[model samples]
Every structure is written in structure tokens, then in C-alpha cells.
Target chain A: MSEIINSPLLWKGAVVTLQLTLYSAVLALILAFFFGLLGSSRHGWARAIGRFYVEFFRGLPALVLMFWFFYSLPLVGIRFETMVAGVLALGLNYGAYGAEVVRGSINAVPTAQYEATVALNMLPRQRMWRVLLPQAVPLMLPPFGNLLIELLKATAIVSLITISDLMFRAQQLRASTGKGTEVFLVVLVMYFVMAQILQLLIRYLERRSERILGRRPRRRAATAIAGTTGTGSLSGVGGEGS
Target chain B: MPSSDTMSEVPTPEDPQGAPMDKTAADGALPHGSTPGIRFEKVVKRFGDNIVLRELNFTVAPGERVTLIGPSGSGKTTILRLLMTLEKLDDGVIWIGDRPLWHMPRGDGLAPANEKHLHEMRKQVGMVFQQFNLFPNMNVLRNLIEGPVRVLGLSKDEAVERARELLDMVGLVDKIDAHPTQLSGGQQQRVAIARALAMQPKVLLLDEVTSALDPELVVGVQDLLRDIARASDLTLLCVTHEMHFAKDISDRVLMFDKGQIVEEGPPEQIFGEPTEQRTRDFLQAILAT
Candidate 1:
């Protein structure tokens, strides 16, 4: 524990790791959007091509893809920086899975919503932007929150690609100081705190969407109040509004 | 995913034309009413092997209240969908005022209009659904304001003010900030109708808008629609199984079965003195239920 306090490198490494996770998550989300849209389209060839992408990347292990991009792309004359390779590989791979989640949410929207849009004579883009996507957000939010947490965990893999992120620095300190237990223990607590914050974000989004789009779950206190008020009135008809 | 990017292919001339069209005798517009509401010309619609409309035709005069009644799959909803331009026609032409929708008259042939044409055509029509497809993400007030602000380009201040007025009309002024999920089926459907009215569409298409409502709530929705139909100049093309409401509000009732219009007349003649056996059978079946 004292070693972590003395090592400025460890703090900087934690910051770097957080940044990598943020960048990769954003990249993954953008790619997943188009992939999901294409995957959901009506054209046979278009959907087939999108399906191939979903299956190919989703089937590969995250570690395997990161290593392959880290080592193998030079063969194709595409030499990304280690940091870029790490983020891009993870983002693209997870994007494939995210696309399916997005598409599933889009499908879960009732056809009646679609028919209403049609009846409005809304343009195709208008129907998607105004009617469909808005509803899909509530459906997509919970699943996407899960993926974001996974991506945060995934940032740990970038250390293998030789990026000086938190985990990499943790490893370096472990080797130099031979305090494996202390280093990992500190990072584990840090991870637990990060996960707690991430869960708080998920809950906030869930509540916001529950208010905006999802089924209105009843609050127990409100129900209790109503029941008590009913019984009180029954017991005393003179119970006044005042 | 059930969703599809249905826009990809350039339609070829495998069929004479890809979409259908129906024509009405294009009456010169009344001096006061500049916009021709909706006219159909020999309109035919098919879903793959199933034909929903066949050589069908009807014209809705501006400010007319036309009720389309038929058994399930009688193409009533399909007609509303066609007017909304949600479904492409198999053949025939549809017109809104002087403009042709569904199919554009191309060089010696007809082509489905580009996305731009579709956008321009959408401005004049509004629809309310039976299932109440209010934007679940928006509160009642926002749901009313969204179309006016986004598609109509109304200022947000003006839109909110008008939204409040429309909410008042639907008798849900108290529920303006309520999320759609918080409203009952009746309340939500009423809001849906008001949202459509907020756009001030030249024609309003109501597709079985009350059929999905609970029995207790149906009357409330029907009363709201009746008020609108009585008060406004908006032409209405309503597909409904509510025979009593349809009879009371409709100027003319079009009775349909299979893929064709079996009979159409003033509501009294069609509902009371039916000339077609199919129309009579439909009325009996619905009334019994």
C-alpha cells in the first residue's frame, strides 16, 4: 500500500487505462450503430454481409483479436501504434456483439408504432429518427450499460499490447518491488470502486429511461400511502381533505 | 431483426410498374379549399401473393368525413397505409390535391418517388393508431410538440403553447407532463389523436383507433374523435369496427370485403339498407360481437 503511494507512475497508469477504455467504448458504439442498421436492413446481400461481420468478430476471443492486431497487421502493411491497435481491435470486436443488441432492441419495438409512423406519412428517415430510435433507446440502454462495464474490464487487455496503462504499470511495479500482493490488492479495490461508479451510472440511466420509456414500476411507498388513505377514510368518513 | 432498410434496390420493370395508383375524378378545387384532400384512381394493392386492394377507387373531398368499414383484411387499414405512403402500391395512382403520390409519372413509365417526394407528400396527412403509438420517451406535452417543432418547424414556444391547447381539447390538460406509460389506454389514445391534430393535417387517417382500447375507455376516445370530426375542416379516412360511432360520424360509409369495395353509400343506406350481401353479413357479424 505504501509502495503505491510512493509510485507516481501507478497513478498516471490508472489515468491512461481509463482513457483507453473511454476511447474504445465510443469507437465500438459508433461502429455498432451502422453494423446494427445494416444487419437490420431488408436487402439480402446487405444483411448477409452484416451477419458475416457479427459472427466473425463475436466468435473470436477478445484476447486473441487484440494479440492478432498487435502482431499480425504488419503482414498486411497496416501498422497501427500499439495503443491504437489495442483499442481498435477491442472496439471492432465488441462492436459486432453490440450491433446484435442494438438490432434486437430495434426489433422489439412493436409494429403498431411503425404503422402509426406510416399513417403520419413520415419519411423513412423521419420514421427512424423520430419514432423508432427514440423507443429503441430505452430497450438498448440496459444492455449497452452491461457492455460498457465489459469494455472497462477490457481495457486491462491493452497492457498485453505494451501500452503503459494501469495494469501494465501495476505489473511493472510488481516486478521491481516484488510486492505482487500489495499491487494487485490496491488495484482490485480501485476496480471495485470503478465498478460501483459504473453501476451507479447504469442505475441513473435505468431510472431516467424508466421514467421516459419503460413500464412504470410502482413505488411501494406510494402504494402504501394510497392503501392507508383508503382504510383511514373507510374507518372515518369524516376524514377531511384539509 | 424485423426492421429492414427497405430502400436499397432500384426497382426494375419486372411488373409494368412497382406501386399501385387509384384516381378520383379530379374536381377543380373549391375557391376556398385550395388543397385537394385525397383521391384514388383504379388503386390496386398486393402483399406478395395476397392482393389487398384490386382496381379500387374513392375520392375524399376536403372536409369530408368518410368511414371505411369492413371485416378484417378488407384493405381498410391498407388504404390508410397507402395514403400514409407506408406501403408501396402494386398498381394505380394516388393523389393529394394536385400532386401525385405513391408513383411519380416518369418517362413513359412510373417510378416510385424518391425520398424527397415522400417527405414533401407527408406534410398534409396525420394518423392516430389503435394501439396508441405515442413516443414512449416523451411526456404528453413533448409528444404533442415534437412534430410541430421538428417536422413543421414551429418555434418551441409556439409549439408548447399550441400543444397545451390541443391537450386541453383532448381533456388531458392535467396530464401534459405525464409519461405515456403513466397514462391508461384510453388516455394515451386520446393523446395520440391530439398529437396528430397538433400538426393540423389536411386529412386525418384513424385506423381502428379505438378498437384496441378497453371497453370503459372506448367511449372517451370516441367522444374526443366525434368532437374533432364535428369541429374541424380536416377530412377523415377512418378504418374502424365501431359501427355505431362510424354511422354517427361518417358522411359516407365504404363497405369492403376481400380486396374490393362491395358497396358504398350514405351511412344510412349502407348501414341501414345494405344492397350487398357481404356488407350485410359484415354488419351482422360486428354487431353481434
Candidate 2:
């Protein structure tokens, strides 16, 4: 158990896993907003394209997508590095699910809000950005937090594409030491810790979004203590759902 | 259909005796060379299988304070909504000032107005809703300034200054930084009124603005509206069940029934001696409650 915990190789692999999670999360988030906005768009062609992307990616398993990107694409004269292939597969898959979250959050904004924007003579873009999206932020946070953690867990699948992630390192260590249980258990705890960290980050963002939107009371004391904290971190996924 | 002394020269389509409902009130209150405040030329609006408004022909003279008093589902609120562009007109044209609302000149003929045309027309109008519809995400000050800065192209500082003045007018300056959710229903509605005023709209539509308030709170809002009516040359189209408020504010009171005006005159004639039985019954039922 000590050796499994102490292994420098395992730490390196954990770094690789963390890198995968971060990169894939970023890609997924961009795609999520793109497809989500498109899916609910007034234009039929945009909605069709958005729907097709979401259904296509969501219907396929993340691991199978990784394999296709890694192996099959190369055979068809399209090549990607191992990590790039893994990130793309995970991003495309998770993004589809996140798009639903985005769409649902946007729709959940009251009809009255839209009407008010119209009454104010807001252009379509202004209505979405200024009114609809700001209101939708608090609603999008919790679900996105969940999706982010799910994306974190899904990074384990990158091991199959020979990315040398935490899961892959654990198998290698188990093979060398002939101790499957110890190696697996340590890796499990590592993954769990990473997920917990991600969850805490998301919770912080949810509170920040609520505060900005004035749905929750502004914690003057906390603001004083944590002086000048910027809202840059969650601007994409947590900024506005709708 | 004898014209009231204070009534503007609005063309009355349903008048048995074709009173020249032109832009010439006997009181001479209407300005010369000004466009009609609002005019519906054989307008029709239907919802699904239900016809809400049927060839609703009426006109509100510029700067005239008109009240649409009717029972629920009589299409009084629908008229306000149509002017505000919240509802699509199924047929005919609605003119706001000199411009057609739902249609625009295309070559030698008229076509359905596109978004840009509608937006330009909407800029001249504002509305206060029953629900207040203040943006929950924004504070009172932000709500007031949003339209001015965004749509009216006022500088942020100019918008804020205007917002402060409007907030002061509405008696909500103290609550400027407060969220819409934090204010009472009446306070929220005041903020909504201020928000609308920030746009400096020429035509104001009031759709039961006090209906959603608590009974005790309705009076204050009505008094504020009365003050606004007294102060501005704005064309006011009001839909309210509050007969006393309607009487206080409206120069011409229209009694609507089944999507048509059953009677219209000065407040005294409509309230004291309604020519139509429908108008009498509706007023009796409403006033009794």
C-alpha cells in the first residue's frame, strides 16, 4: 500500500489524467454552448445541425470514439496524437449531454422575462446576452458541475488509448508488483480526490453566480476577506445557461 | 352616437350615425398636424380556434388618455398587447403615429413588417404589465437604465441619471439598488413604470398595471399613474377594471364587449348613462365587486 501511494510513476500518470480532464472539459464546454445555442435557435437549419451533433456523439460510447479517432482516422489519412484523440473523443461525447443542460436551462427562463425584453425594444442578441443569459446562470451551475465531475471520471477511459493516465499507471504498477487491489484502491482514491476538488470549484462558482445575479445575499464579509476576486473562471459554463 | 365634448376626433366604425371620427375633437385638445396616437384599421386577432379581436376599428388621438374598460376575455387587454407588439395581428393594419406597426411599404404595396421595422416602431412605445415583469437578475437601477442605454443609445451615465430621475418620480429612489424580488409588488410595479419611462416613449400602454397588486397597494400605483397622465403629453392607452382610476385618468372611456366597443364617451356619460346594456351590466358587475 505504501509503495502504491509513494510511486513517482503514479503521480506522473495522475498529472496526465488531470491534464486530460482540464483540456477535455474546456473543449466540451465550448461545444456545449455552441450546440446548445444552436439547438434552441429559431432557424431550422441551425437546430438540425445542432441536434445531429448532439445525437451522434451521445449515441456513441466515449471509449469507442477514442479508438476511432486514434486508429480508424489514421487509416483514412487523418492522424492525431494519442492525447489529442483521447481529448476529442471525451469532449465530443460529454458536450452532447451538456448541450441538453444548456437548452433546458435557457428554456426554464420565464416567458415574462422575454416579454419584458421585447417591451424594452431589446434586439434579439441583446435580449439573450443581457437579460435571458444572466437569469439562466444560477440555473446552469449545478448541472454543469455534475457534468464536469462526470467528465473528470470519464478521463479514466483515456487509458485504453494508451495515454498513460492514472488508470493506465495503476495497471502497469499492478502488473509489476502483483498487487491488483492495492494499486486499484490508491488510484480510486486519487480519482475521488480530483473529483472532490472539481466539485468544490463548481460550488464556489454557483455561489459567485448567484451573488452576481443578486438571487442570494451578497456576503459583504466574504467579499472583504477575499478582496477583488474576479468572475473570469466560470464565465463560459457558469456565466449563463440560457 | 353623439360625441362627448372632450372626445378626440377618432373615427368610430360602429357608430350608427357616422360621426366624422376624424382627428378633430370639439375641445380642440388635439394638436394640429399631429399624427393619430394609435389607429386600428379593420384589425383582427385570433388565437387558435378562438377569435379574440374581430375587425376592431378604433383610434386614439395623440396625447389623449383613453381607457378600455371591459369584462375579462372582452379583448381589452388584447388591444394593449397588439399596440405593444406582444401579439401578431392576423389581418389589417395598426398605425402607431404615422407608421404602420405590422406592415411596411414594399415597392408599390405593403408587406408584413420585418424585425428591424418592428423594432423601430416599438422604440416609440412602452408598456407596463400586470405582473410588473421587472428583470429579476437586475437591481431596480439597472432595470431602469437597461432600456435607455441599450435601445435608446444613451450613454451609461446619462441612462443612470435618467433612471435616478424616474426612480425619484416613482418614489423608489431608496430602493434603487434593491433587487426586483426584494421589493413589494407595488414597488416592483413602480420600478417597471420607471423602467418604461426611461425609454421616454411617446405612447404608453397600461395593461391592468394595478391588477396584480394587493388591494391596499393598488391606490398608490393608480395615483402615481394619474400624476404621470397629468404631467405628460404622452398618448395613454389604459386597460383597467378600476373604474374610479379609469374615470380619473381617461379623457375618453371606451366600453368594450366581445372584442368590439359597445360604447365610448367622456367618463361621466359612460359611467352614468351607458347607452348599451352590455356596458351597463359590465360596469354594474365590476363596480359592485
Using TM-score, give the best candidate's number: 2
Across A178-216, the per-residue lDDT of candidate 1 in tens digits comes to: 989999998887766776778678756755665456454
Error of 1 at B88 (Å): 1.6
lDDT of 2 by residue, B173-288 (tens): 89989988788899999999888877877888999999999999999999888877766667889999899999988888998877777789889899989888888889889878
Candidate 2 TM-score over all chains jointly: 0.88
**List of chain A TM-scores, every candidate:** 0.84, 0.89
lDDT by residue (A114-136, candidate 2, tens digit) is 98999999998999899988877
C-alpha TM-score for every candidate: 0.78, 0.88
Model 1 stretches astray by more than 4 angstroms: A1-19, A34-61, A72-81, A118-126, A164-197, A214-242, B1-37, B107-109
- Total backbone collisions for each predicted model: 16, 3
Q: Of the candidates shown, which would achieve the greatest lDDT relative to the real structure?
A: 2
Q: Residue B97 of candidate 2: its Cα lDDT?
A: 75
The TM-score obtained for chain B by all candidates, in the order given, is: 0.86, 0.89
Q: Write the per-residue lDDT of candidate 1 for residues B1-289, one digit (tens) a residue.
A: 1111211121212212221212112111101124356777778898888989887766776667789998899899999888887788788888887778876778887788876787788778888877888877678988888777877888999989887877777778999989887788999998898888877777888989888888998888897787677655567799988988998677778787876777777788988899888888888998898
